[model samples]
Target: MTRALSAFLVLFGLIAPALAAPQNKDGDSAEAIDLLTQASKAVRRETYRGIIVYLRQGDVDTLKVVHRYYDHEEQERLISMSGQVREVIRKGDKVTSILPDHELVLVSEHPPKSMLGGMSHFSPKRLKANYQVVDLGTARTAGRDCRVIAIRPRDKFRYGYKMLIDSKTQLPLKLNLLHHGKRLEQMMFTDIAFPDHIPDSEFVPSYDVHGFRIVRHQAVHVSESASDKREEQWHATNLPPGFKLAEDGVRQLTSDASVRQMLFTDGVATVSAFIAPAGLRAPLKGATRMGAVHAYGDIVDDTQITVVGEVPAITARRIAQNLVQEKNTAKKAPAAND
Candidate 1:
């Protein structure tokens, strides 16, 4: 997939170890769960603006974000403060990205709840099975007193997260993505403000995109008949503990080609499995890692199988290796251009 398309899909899709602090014995787990639940709600229900620093691998970038929640709908705009000049505007599910360096614009539909910070609706009760939530005491971020919380993985199949939530507004001020006690990626707000009212003009792009090359990715929902057939044709026989199939459908990337996708999640972590016809491009064999995101690919029954997620490399490989394509269920579709 193109970088823009991958980003759009992945959005519709990490953290660090904690310092030595006294763990609360009483009400710690319950408090951590409550805090996380509040933070998730705050992300969608509050209007705020801030400067965020995003670090992945060894590179860093800065962004200015303006978010507004009104009438039960959310709108946000992010402008690059460092590196290439770019902007992203998200109103509900439709996302418009403006790349000034390339003079390109990408318009695509994504899940409305997907945020640039990667926080989404999650079930605290369900997450308990695979991750241990703990209150890591207090810390300060963005000049606000915050409560530190850690969601530690029970096994190596998944990663961990450390969050510093504003004590007053319950907004997440900093988030760290961790693997094996090492940091993979980190996003922290350098400055933030919760405003009483944010005008609509704040969400508009600052640059004129009238002459930029525009690419639109349309999502074609599968018919009921096709969806039933898809369920029978693809499945993962072996999945890690607590992981369940959350979404399954076929997405039309282009007019002539479609890809079958199945999304699996353990409440806190998610994995996506994609199946497209072979020869669309060179198949992505074996495994690869881009920061915290791991992808594994293989070929099955003349189809290309790629499993991608922000989980461990082994988790992606296991999911890719266990996919089973039923025989004679349906004919292969047209190849998708990656």
Candidate 2:
């Protein structure tokens, strides 16, 4: 599945240690959970606007974000403050990305919620099961006192997270993505304010509409097959522990019905498998690595299979090389009456 998370990862994305953290004598394990839960809830319950400094390697981006929820409806706008005039506006499930540099307006439908939207779907119980939740005391972020929490993974399948959560509001102020003891990406709020009310005009796109091309990605022609058939056609016999098949589907990208997709995740990390006719898309020769994201591709039985993820190159290659074309025995089997 090409999700909002993957789109975000394509531009910005990490792993951490597998060792468990030694907790302090006075700290309770559940306190970490409570703090994370509060942070998740605060995304929807509060209206805030801030300047976010996103850093990945030598690339740094200053983004201004305004997010609010009114009458059960959520709206958000993110604009690049440096470099190109790029912007992404989201209202509910509709996402509109305006790239002034490219002079193109791309529109697509995304999920109602995403990890970038402060994942409310993230389960603390699942996190505890897959990681070691550590409370690292307190610090100051965005001029507000914050409680520090570090969620380190127990295996190589997922990434680690360190967050400075606002003490009173329970909002995240500074977040770091770690991998193998190194920080790969960082998100910190320089200045932020939670308001009693946010204006609707803040969500509007003030970009020039004249002479710009608009592409409706939401209207893409995709013919879907049964989910069961998709599962039968593709199988990941070997997967990292704690990772599971989150979603799978077979869909025609255009006029052909050979394109298939499968999504796997360990809650913290996600990977995508795309299978299609060899001639349908550009064949990935060997492997490519960019920052934290990696992709590998190969041709099997005259079909192209590509695996992509924000993971180690070894992990990406392993997933790509292990693509197995399992026969759909369920659909081929004779009926009970037969």
Candidate 3:
């Protein structure tokens, strides 16, 4: 896949899953949940500037970020301080990615979510059912005292996380993505400052883009007739325990092609399945990994199925294998709501 397509898939497929929470038996469940709750809120409510280091697949990239919350909305800017010169600016649901190296700009509507720094707001009752939350004592990051908390998966289907939350602001100063007790990705802030005010100009793009190619991704609208037909054509036969289909729809990928997307979540971890015509492009027939994200692809009934998530390889492979085209006209269960 091209770099732009890979980035789009990561945004729409991998990072878009919702989380469900359960109770923890290993540590103080109430304290763990409360701390997580606070950290989640701080990510959205606090306005700060920081320098963050991201480590993935033995590669490190640094970023400078400025975020502000005003009028109940979020405005943030992130600029790469290493490797390629790229920038991401978000104002609420609209996100613009600037690639200086490619002279390209991608604009899309994305929910405010993060795989590295932000915490998903989840139900404690639901979260406790799938994972064990524990207080792992104290640690220090960015010269500030922090509380270490671990959210370990109850099974091997999903990944786990270790977070260092700032003692005063409740912001996450460090985060580690774990799989099978091994670190897959890590992000930590080396310096951060909470500012009283961040001007609007701070969120503007730093690079000039007078001749850059801008690509806008708009939501596709399928008619009721087409939607009903698709509902009878494909469905997932088996879902992992605690997982449920959260969202499914047809998305326009090009003028002549569209793909059906299904999002599944077990409250904390999420996976996404995409189905398209086998001839849409070259089919991916195996597994691939990029840091904590795992993707599996296969062909079913001449249709292409690809599953991607921040879950284990087995989880993605199982999800892809279970997505089958219906041989009969039997109606399937509707997707669940978050």
Best by lDDT: 1
**Tens-digit lDDT track for model 3 on 49-152?**
98888888899888888888899987878888888888998887787999989999999774443222233433345555677778898999999999998878
Residue range 1-338, candidate 2, lDDT tens digits: 12222223221221111122233343435677566656655654568899888777678778888888778876788888887788888787688889988889988875533322223323434445677777899999889999998877776766677888899887677877778878877778899999888888898887986788999753222234444455446777566656566666555456544566777666567788888878876678679876667888877767788988876666667677666776643333221210
Error of 3 at 259 (Å): 0.5
lDDT of each: 0.73, 0.67, 0.72
Ranking by lDDT: 1, 3, 2
Which candidate wins on TM-score? 3
Clashing pairs in 1: 14-177, 15-176, 15-177, 15-178
The whole-model C-alpha lDDT of candidate 1 against the native structure comes to 0.73
Per-candidate TM-scores read 0.84, 0.81, 0.85
Clashes of each: 4, 2, 11
lDDT at position 81, candidate 2: 88
Task: Show the lowest summed lDDT stretch of 10 residues, model 1.
Answer: 11-20
List the lowest-lDDT window of 10 residues for candidate 3: 1-10
The TM-score that candidate 3 achieves is: 0.85
